[model samples]
Target: MTKPTLPNTTSSSNQKLPSTAHSPVFRLRDMFKPSFDLWVISWILGLVTALSMITLLMVSGWFITGAALAGMIAVGSHSFNYMLPAGIIRMLAMARTAGRYGELMVSHNAVFDLLKTLRLRFFNRLAALPLVQQRNTLHASQYMHRLVSDIDKLDEFILRVISPWLIASVSLLLLAGFIGWALPLSATSKTIIYLLLLSALLLPLMASLKGIQSAKRLSQVSESRRQKLLAPLAIITQLLLWQQWQAQTKSYIAQDDRLQALEWSAQKLRSSYMLLIQWFFYAAVLVVLFSIYQLTDSSTSLTTGVDVPLVLAVTLGLLGIQEIVVPLGQHYLALGNSISAKDRLNALLQPSVSEAQANSTIPTDTETGLALPTGPLHANLTHVSAKIPGALVGAKEVSVRIDSGTPLIIKGPSGCGKSTLLQALAGELPVQSGEVKLNEQDWFAYNWQDQLGYLGQQLDIFDQTLAANLRLGKPQATEAELLSALDKVGLLTWLQAQPQGLQTPLGEYGAAISGGQARRVALARLLLKPRRVLLLDEPFAGLDNETRERVWDSVREHQKQGLLVVVSHHEWDMGQCDVLTLKENVFID
Candidate 1:
């Protein structure tokens, strides 16, 4: 039962420090541009509301103090004792409560708005990066984590740290000014003293840095270990079948031991930081009390004039200020965590394309008899070579040419660069030495999204309704069009047989469907799209013979309107169609 030891690293060092720091102020500035004026306005309104609430709370304390002193002076007088102060205190409480509720509402709305904008911009940046850049630069799991967990951290940054600090700083400054004006000497002295005390509050934050780093490092190690353990489990389940259960159990135990060790180290670090904060709190309390005594002793005339009730009110107000400042260290630490997360996210958002690289735009001609456009064209690629990470280099000097009403078959061995050529045609692969043209223009000349259809080797089916998955291909396709597409792909009958028909959810990655059925569903999608060109990579690779024949028929039938380029290993009888062999060059043999 003994746990293994995990490596301990300082929290600051453990954080994924950005190669270049982003100015939070610059981020804020970009957010406040004309396009995001509404968000800027919302944030301002929320800050104003929060500060207003703080002011209301301070004012309520003042009124309560005044009322108490009045009551003490008129102890025997029924009207003074019973009426005025009670009414005033009730009103003040109600007002303060209303302000607080309003502040919370506004602040939450502001944070939510910011979150939406940030997520959208981040996704857009990720989308704009070249496909090759994304494939080589990022991990699927890590990108997923950044898209989800890092955004949540950004929410905390806005709601807990940034917004609150703005409100606190503004409110404190206003409150200090008010205090200074009312009791000049005492207020000025206390304001200076409080400012000094604020510096001490940062001590807890400095101490917590160690814990923060430890927690972040532990989190990363835990994630890495979990993935490592799960990867074997994933492979075993798919490949080994019977022995997976026992093997997975043993691996899980080892991973769990390492995680446990990391958890222990994190807990120890957190506890140490908390202990230091507690000591700092005690010191802060002592300082506040000592300052209070000094103020009362030095200004006896003012103290008598203000009375015990006023002193108590001022004391409570000061205590509120202390409460706000004391936990600033913890807040600062959270801010640091947020800063680290933001930096990581921002790095992901940087542009991956280079302007100086002209080789990515080169073009070549298709080797097959598939007609290259005489006039304007839909899709073309020249000398395109795609190198997928971990996969062999794909399709060197690949040149494809197709226009409307031409269908080409690309036959090659498994991993012989057929799919890569297909992707290059679709403008989804970076051209290493050639140009890709779509619609008689350079592929990069215009948006290629609506001009082509791509069915990758793996069918990316989400866990959603059959209809929903199809809709992803062509969102505006009519119900009749959808039924026609499904019918053409020979999936309409099976789809209708399901209890919920189109509404029935496809399990994760279409696990509920047979491999042939998944391929048919993908075909149905291709049929639904209005794109002028289609690039299919091994669409029928996993299907049975009968299903494969049916899929080929569907492809041939659809070949009359749009250009079709298919990559396959099967000896497809593509009657009278131009065939391209990848062994050397495009050919009719």
Candidate 2:
């Protein structure tokens, strides 16, 4: 068979995209843009609730003082109508209650809606990342856990920092205006009150700005500590056996202590700032009261100056506003937390250098798209240095060629980069400074997904029925085909023993199946759709010797006309094939 001529595809590496478009400010703004209307409604409702609370307190105080004075005067009490004041108090109370309820409902609904949108965007962006970046840079739970926590912090951001600060500002401004209208006050009193409100608002912001560095450090340290405390069981045991358990334990404890110390410092900082703002508010209240008292002329019988009832009302209203304002000062920590969360999320979401290169370099044949070599497909690597991203060492200056006739077995000690080398061939790790060619063409110039099958060490089983999972390999596959594939992997007996057979549920991560059965099931699925190249990482792990040989024979039979590359610690007793052993950047056969 002659190799088919494929259309030439150009790499996108020369294409330059502007970097400023992805700035943190722009990203945050973009995050909010989708739910802009919801955010607006939330802010408006928050302001309404806060204002209602302040007004309700003010009116109640006025009504109580007026009624008390009227009762004391006897004649005044007989003529004074209590019904209007009582009705007004009831109305204010209702408004306060209703507004608060509405704000809570709308705000929480908005948060969930916004989070839904953000989570979708986050995942979409994650999917768009190059396969190399996904496999190498990110491990099991590290990024996934951080993504959840970071998203949760945004909930706190909207509710605690953004909502409270916005409500406080507008509420304070409106209250100041209302107080000016209700009370006969001098410019000095208005000035002092306004200054106090402004100071109260800015104090939290100042504290947030000052603590940004510390807050970021706290976030980092906390995550590090968490990861340390939850160190993988495999790693912990290895360290224990190495006699380094004491040092590792000390390190974990040290991280815990540092995390606690940072938290304590943050609490102290917030408390100190709150105390300062509270003291200023109290002093301002005294000053306002004194200013109002100076307007009182006792000889004039409460006509020339502010009335006693009015004085009492304004004083109580000032205190009411103070109550609303104090929480703003306490929001500094929340503000810092939100900022830090935003920073960390942005950093994580940003594409790595290799990802950017892959985005720019990977190509597709638009004219004659994805021409899988019909003749023998051969994979060749030339001085290919590749590593798991963020790792200190990996395969370096390595070269190998995988041919179609004989399968390739990669043997190496753990951490010797055998898997990394396999990933390089599978196009899941970008080469540092070499060429990976398939059929004498740059692999990136063609789409290899349709022509390649990879079975990693981890099982890719879902919580689904056996037939449904089998259908994933060949969606239109019939029952007979499913049975044939299972029997090929020596699982037909086991399947027949199950009452439901193909309809049996696999449970989460194939929890219902043994490790060996899961591996065989995965192998059968891969066999259902044969590929030009098959890469299996520890495919026979967890199997007995007899079962392992049977599964190996099935795999070899399936891939006889194709190419096979496997990474395993176990010895294969099969006939002669290519064997490559990796050791410290060198490839030996």
Candidate 3:
């Protein structure tokens, strides 16, 4: 038998990628393969704990009834012998307590281990995605919020849905056997007991089938509602300044109302299902009591027809079984959520059809040998029109040629696809029409990503020391190289002002520094490593005119022997660089 492998992908352009259409359930099963032993241990402990509680109640009921009847007669009281029964009851109590504690400890440990495995697996797959897919702003935000919630929901697959049903079914069977042996039940009573046991098996399965769609919808609406409420936080100040905060608050309230309606619908379904189970069990209990009454009235004495103490014990045990059975109905809600979560996580691994098609056309010759050509580097875009994945506006019919000495500066308004054009050049956005070529070859054909440096609007900063963070761009960079890059980005004076200098911690996402300082630090990090081509988006953001001009000079000097493409809103003193301006998605020379 072949071992089932988890989903895996590659960033290679021409490699024949394996299909990621693995079954979701199969993937979920694979997650538990590593922790099989822990699951078994937890399951056994849970079964033992449930059975112990049921038996404890039955035995306690029997002892109490027997003792009470014996006390009614002087001669029988001496023969009853309370010592053994009391000792048995004490042992049972201890066993019940110990089993419950052990079950909780083992089950929770197993869940935590499963959670760790799931998170690691998710991150591993996430790392395998293409750089373009990874940098998508909207998708990135959704992934962070949904990944945590979806992974957390998966724990219920084992805890509430699988284990509870297994333990309850087994305990019910054992209790039925004990009742049949201890008391002489008639055909009618036996039939009722058998029917109740059958119902316990069938009802939860039915309820889960009905609840699946409801639970799935609840999960989706909840996530949507969360995103809706959080979307305004990024621009709350602007909204308040424009006197539109009230409108945004009203939109939030509407989304919240929709979420609450779905939540209530799910809760109502679960409650109704549980209530049905409770009433059915209660009705079965009454039928059993009526049968007992009929058997007693027809017999000469209670001792011959039915044992009254054993009957009472069975009755109480049936009531205990009701407690175990009701939860089976409730867990169907969790079953639906887990199934939905599993499907969503599975979708992440599958390669999109368009990406696969694009990869198919890549030439085999260009798969290897990613080294750039000798002498000056040059890039050409022939009538290239591209857009961000979901956006409507982007670069249209743009044709340009940029050589090593003459850098290209892209000028545009706020939303005129300047960044999108840079993204197209860096292979981060797919061209809808035309082609981007490096040295007269297809841009995608040459695996020159390592020799290419691209910076987006967001600064990828980490909570680490200045030197430590700079080391990310060039792992083996020396102290002098690090200081040189910092000087190029005009952060030398700021670094000198810090008490710890190179060792100063940036705090989480560079919160300890000013915006301009953080931006310079990010730029400095990027410049530490040499690249044949550089694409920078708004590189001079948050900088004063003097600082911006100083950094521009350094940038020009750094790219003297390479091609440079920049997107900027601010005008600069153009030396010899070619300018392409974008207005309403069309580029003009």
Which candidate comes out best when scored by lDDT?
3
Pairs that collide in candidate 1 are: 11-213, 362-434, 362-435, 363-382, 363-434, 363-435, 364-382, 377-439, 377-440, 378-439
Ranking, lDDT, top scorer first? 3, 2, 1
lDDT of 1 by residue, 548-580 (tens): 787678777775677778887778565766677
**Which residue segments of model 3 deviate by more than 4 Å?**
1-18, 21-26, 73-77, 137-143, 227-262, 297-300, 348-369, 569-574, 586-589
lDDT of 2 by residue, 162-198 (tens): 7787787787777677768877788878888788867
| TM-scores, one per candidate | 0.68, 0.87, 0.87
lDDT of each: 0.59, 0.75, 0.76
Query: Which parts of model 1 have CA positions greater than 4 angstroms off?
Result: 1-82, 131-139, 174-306, 353-384, 396-408, 433-451, 460-484, 492-512, 528-532, 542-547, 560-563, 572-589
| Overall local distance difference test of candidate 3 | 0.76
lDDT of 3 by residue, 130-212 (tens): 54555562267777767777888888888888788888888888887886787677877888877876786688889887778
Pairwise lDDT winner, candidates 2 and 3: 3
Which scores greater on lDDT, model 1 or model 3?
Answer: 3
User: RMSDs, each prediction?
Assistant: 10.3, 4.4, 5.3
